[model samples]
Target chain A: MLNPIEWSSGPDGEIPFGTPFPFSVPFALASPESPGLYLEGVRRIKERGGRLVSLWGSWTSGADPAVLAAFSDAEGLLLYRFRLSADDRSFPSIAFLFPLANRLERAVRDLYGWDPAGLSDQRPWLDHGLWDGPPMVPQDASFQRSPEGADSPQEEYPFVRVEGEGVHEIPVGPIHAGIIEPGHFRFQVVGEKLLRMEERFGFAHKGVRTLFRNRSVSDAARLAGRVSGDSAVAFQTAFSDAVEVATGSPPPRRALWIRSILLERERIANHLGDLGALGNDAGFGFGSVQFGRLKEEFLRTNARIFGHRYLMDTVVPGGVAGDLGRQELALLREECARTKSDVLELKTIYDEHGGLQDRFSGTGWLDPMLAGRWGLGGVAGRASGQMYDLRHSHPVPPYDQVHVPVSISRLGDVSARVQVRFQEVRHSLSFLDSVLEALPEGPFFIQPEETFSPFEGVGWVEGWRGEVLCWVRLGSGGTVLDAHCHDPSWLLWPALEQTVPGNLVADFPLINKSFNLSYSGHDL
Target chain B: MHKILLKIFRTGTLTEPLPEPGPPVKPCPLVRGSLAVRHVDAGSCNACELELHAFTQAFYAPESIGIRFVASPRHADVLLVTGPVTLAMKDALRAAHEAMPDPRYVIALGDCACNGGIFRGSYAVSGGVPEVIPVDGQIPGCPPEPKRILAYLEQLVSAENKD
Candidate 1:
């Protein structure tokens, strides 16, 4: 094992060190030297062939706000934290170095009021200039806001303008035509060709981060599960993992196996839905109806087995809330086999279909280099040849036992994304088979200790969308001091902006569905 | 083409008869015809949306029962709102509600929209759809299943038929 203290300390001084959490390397650098050390650490990690997993900020009472950035290295996951003091709340922007840090820094600015000194875009993220004050800031007797009076006029957002002949701007909603979440997309176009695209999200920001504060560990896990509905299992697992690590107790073997099953089911459900939607967007109604029927079957099975279609609240802090019997396990296995055969048949049909190929072949190409620079992951990143899947790269208990295949393609178009999803679905099916066959016999859950030391824990899970990282700090008696749930959409959304530039405005839905980044996830 | 045609023939229609409207759905004379719904996601986790999408699938085909999702509120008779209204989305939700023609029915879907569910009283959230706009009915669950949504709509239709 790498020496935590030695790697955490720097030239400036010895930084504070926390006990290393499972699958996480934690370090805290002083505010003065944080900018340089953070940049240097990022460079070293990149040079050593590591990918930046997540970047977020956490603030506790009576301390400086700490910006935590997690990276996946060959050894495992490494979390580097930088403390920014209240007096001097500015740090050198790493967005200048890493494009992924652009939105993260803006988020930190919007939530905690910590300014990233050299950030190129200073526009408020997750904040539309409507709130009374920075909501995430700790409220004391001294902290007071002006009383509410007449509602202020809606603030005009400054979308970047592109100037040229025949260039016109088209603004789409925070309220769309579909039954999806709300987000605004601005497109700069000349006739049919698009010049640039800008996205403004956060319409779904429900103060999720602040809601986690001061809650009991179990209550917090419930909130985390809803961070993004589709990724509920992944988010809950990460939160539970963090709590388990903090309490210094690993969940039982049976619980870990159940968690893996839940994660795989979540992945399959999302991929099935996305595939159908992508087909529908490409004008293939047959594929949509077929795949949609398959997804409903899967969801119905989940409801029958797990008691909820989305499997919300199934994962608690120590372990899962429910258990599976022999009958259910056998049914799941049979269902998996049936779905695999059907999907295989559909795959041949999709590949041979001329119209789908025509629309999907050359549309929405994201270069591998750009994908790497922006730190995109999950299916979208894999399609662009960024070979970083956490299931294989940083395997935890159950995954460590079973093998996970990383899917990749060089095309980076809608077709490539679709292909990756199909391959991943096959892989997940085989994985489920092995996992269920080797299902361990043990207690499903254990009650964690009520009292916890003042320590921090980081939970990292490979969500269907991408890597999800949850950081938590527990005070005495296990009260949540601070918590941050970082979603992969932060990185993937920017990739959408890049891929949509040259494609027609009509093809935007197809490409966007191909990525399917979560607005709720990013907005939170 | 033969395989496609064969598959289509093999997959026969899967629509079911609409359930009976419950007590809450009172008949409104103005809405005694096919209903057009405009879904506005005020601030949901998208679970409700997924369930809502299921309403259009083979099993629970709402289209066969005179309910269709419209593209614009101007063409819609009912506004199906989800989530606890977020601060950034409050204005847009109101605008959508305003755009609907007179006698517009508002149905709040999911626990978040009905009462704010778990996200209630947060700084960025206003807690429930009624906080932002008037709601005529509510279908409550973390996300009410497709069957529940269909039942609620059937209630509205039956209520109109009664009128």
Candidate 2:
């Protein structure tokens, strides 16, 4: 008897009419009517100690501010788009308030030639030190990287120098020994302890955000889903939320529930795999093989039930692309039940193992104050006693029906993160069971009636890693203006730099595996 | 001897699970003449590497299909890449593909390997494996379910058999 429409309603679901949500500043604040308003909004967010979650700009050449503001407030996140014209004098900078804004500001400056003042770190983000041309300006009617040229490492890279005594430098890869992602971690180490660490990232800067310009909204959602593999459901949901706000497409209740189910599944799957990897790093072979076995079996059943192991192409804009029958739902419930028992047993082994517990406990402590400054989200923040889970903070879809307790630990170590993930998996499994039991009967999708207009909106989903914030602008005839996906790694990666200090070089993998921040999620 | 006993005890049987026949086996069209594989890690923690290792592990034993992972590009027939290609790996990706002998195929494995999945827009990624090399087969998932990987390898080997 639960209508999907009624089910979707909540404080998070409802847009405040009198005053815009504090998280979401109106687009008019960025318009010519209020030149300094954008800066003021940043100041307000900074005053409240809110870290810059994401900063994205697109060419909204002829878009209306009112329409853009409407879309922004609808999604319950700060949304702003500024028009770029020949006569425009200056664009406001947010780095003054948010230290994390330094990289994003540099990216905007490098990509679209947007002037970002007061930025401390100005090395190129997306350009890969290739182009001398205007950043992000459409040349030849398209915004692709300019023709390739040989750029030297010393000349191309301009890392902020940090000098001190007995600070021997150890630079580990753009290309590493193992087949992991290419990133150069320059560490200033005095023996085993890391004095300082600087990350030289953006090595695989694909022109994804630029590519979105002029592509249809529907097509762009598919691209958004692929932005991050493990968090595909979360990314797609954020994009879908933005699109739904822009085009006024509220998906059917069943669709929303299905989307939530896929997201939780994605979370559980990634957590399971990482749990095994972390155990492997600790020399606990028994736990590794056992957890890995569970993960494999979990994925096999996922493929059988959802038709894709990682559940690709399952979530589209407005509603889910795939349908789940009653039998399949029952099968999924069975799979979750089976996996839960094995995972619980594995947890007992992990807990009883004093070797792992000794290594994982109090290894990496990310203080709550530091977490707040960096705006860390998801498990990393939760492990460090920053109690913020999106499902609880801002319930979306099926989460509204099922209450999720925010798990936290003050220890802020490798074990803390492991425990957080364990608890979350159990929470997700229980929620999935509840959702299947309460599955509503109705149409899964709601087709958009309006012929697509170039509108701007924001989509925010609490991915397994953390909150994934996506800023999307639709171009003429519903084509993409610019779509920027800011993965949780944006914040978590910086947190990794801060937390790795005082820990032995050997313990880096354990600490890193504990966090498991996605390199691909942050790269694009 | 210990492993054999452990395997038997684990399964309660002497043999591994086998697929019922009828799955298609096609050799990689791009590698009609020979097979050489170049690996590029865009950005992954190493889950995909385990699966790749599993292909060589005694448990899976993929060499019977004549699917060997190559280290050098000159001797490689297929480019089997993993992780979400980060910004730093771009040059290496191009260089690896350029070094490979002609008629090479690219097989993207894992979620990040296919479309830079979880790592899509990270500061370091160049995108999926295909963007780095000309991919013929895409094996998706967070380190694809080993069976899917085995199936893909069988197809690549069978395609080579046809040639």
Candidate 3:
């Protein structure tokens, strides 16, 4: 079985390749619907304790859309590919077996119009009637992308309704009050208490998958980084690693070490910002100021070291775009030391503040059993006892070399999520402290030769939110044929609905911020 | 409370001066030195929004310079929009802009908002914010830094306020 307890015994370190094993035989189900290889493949993986990391669909010029599901277990990643005939536009939906696949399957339908057979929720996901046809298909291929897509009225979303005494609905925005990304939230509430909450996204979809199609490796990496923007380094790292894998060009050991520095810095910056936001959401304005100042300082230091504050496009194919020399490393260490104590002090304030604690504790409680069943990945997952971190379990290079600690909790409340952030920041900073001492000496970036033959690659990185997975196929002369960058938010957003009900309607923002699910990441 | 105050004292004030304004905007004395801005996210990657949040911190105290981010478009002098205007958000952006009171200015805050930056040809996006609604000015960057964003708003305020 594929338990997460053992190390990956695969040859090329975790990522499995060759013609996927699912296609070895027809593997039909006895039921009349049969559901075929797709259902059976997911069922087997589920039986072996595999978590649905990501599910995406792609199509070639002549062929119809083919769906692929990625499952993560002790063996790193196991991929299931089911190529459908041009006639049958639907495939067996695995949402019933693995609940996390629900939104993903819906999204696949929205993008490619491929039906997830027997999916309960058939509502439009990313297609807010923006485009007439599947945007994933090229203009010359399956269907034409109508220029007058705006002429079509958006389909009315079918939000689940709840009725009772004093039960009313509150619909909050695609254009939210705050300067955050757009997403709609429908709440079924009685007075101040929420009975049910359903999230609606796709207000931020920019067709990044289609944009990624014809671009070169460099441009594709940049586009991938923008898929969420905040997780630029994570996306860039994942994409670059994917391309590296496809081309069979792993960068030098020093490059991998430097990549780790950028990754940790990205994590710390985001954590500092989110921690502050969480405190503010919990009614602590002081938390915003203190942590905001610290985060600003952190970003300024990033701009000094790497040209961009968010370190966008820093990690490219083969290696990173830049390196940290002795001087840069020294500056980073000094900043690290300064912020480390400040974060500690701020954490103390957040911990000791009775008001903050009262608001955080028991707010947005996600049951541990529900969490495990859904296979939540990332920080929120860790808080809810999912207890999986790619850095520790499936280490790639520098992570493999160094000891990466995972912070876990079974509380599964907003406070536990916040607590996980604090501990994680501490862990990341310590990782930086240890690694910055002696960055291996070598060339930072390696230029890879272009390949005309088609090759496939997959990359999984422990992003700030959780595991960000990228799968890519390179066409002639280093061009991207098809690519899908999967965000950890895909799993967490559905989990957000579970956290909100039974909590105060007003605490939604605080709870939402605690999880900090990415609307852009999810929508894209 | 004592520790909080002490910490505040230790940190002190880190606010920087808003830059002297220069622009081609029509000068008006109405609501001089004070502007209520409503920010709308059409379809940004949230990088623009991250920088927008910098206004809340000590170093970039936006209220000190008389710029407040209002929640409603009804109580605003300007509408700040970010990202490429995705097809789903076109109507919502229009509705928000229409909701704003007269003599309102709509400024595209990033490259994507200005000319659809990198998300231009995607089937999901209609175009930049300008394509969806008329824009008075643009602050273009993948994401303009906090200082530049502050500077642009200052220009608008300066133009609005008579000497």
Mind giving the per-residue lDDT tens digits that candidate 3 earns over A458-486? 77889999999888888779998889999
Q: Could you tell me which residue pairs clash in candidate 3?
A: none
lDDT of 1 by residue, A106-142 (tens): 8777776667777768577788877776677787523
What TM-score does chain A reach in every model? 0.93, 0.87, 0.92
For model 1 chain A, the run of ten residues with the poorest summed lDDT? A144-153
Task: Give the Cα error of residue A169 in candidate 3, in Å.
Answer: 0.7
| lDDT for residue A261 in candidate 2, whole number 0-100 | 89
True contacts kept of 2: 0.29
lDDT of 2 by residue, A147-182 (tens): 221121335465555577777888876755444556
Report chain B TM per candidate. 0.93, 0.77, 0.91
lDDT against the true structure, each candidate: 0.82, 0.65, 0.81
Question: Candidate 3 versus the native: TM-score?
Answer: 0.93
Task: Give the CA lDDT, 0 to 100, for residue A234 in model 3.
Answer: 91
Which residue pairs in candidate 1 have backbone atoms (N, alpha carbon, C) closer than 3 angstroms, thus clashing? B27-B159
Q: How close to the true structure is residue A373 of candidate 1, measured as C-alpha lDDT?
A: 66
Q: What does the interface RMSD come to for each candidate?
A: 0.8, 5.8, 0.8
Structural similarity to truth (TM-score) of each candidate: 0.94, 0.79, 0.93
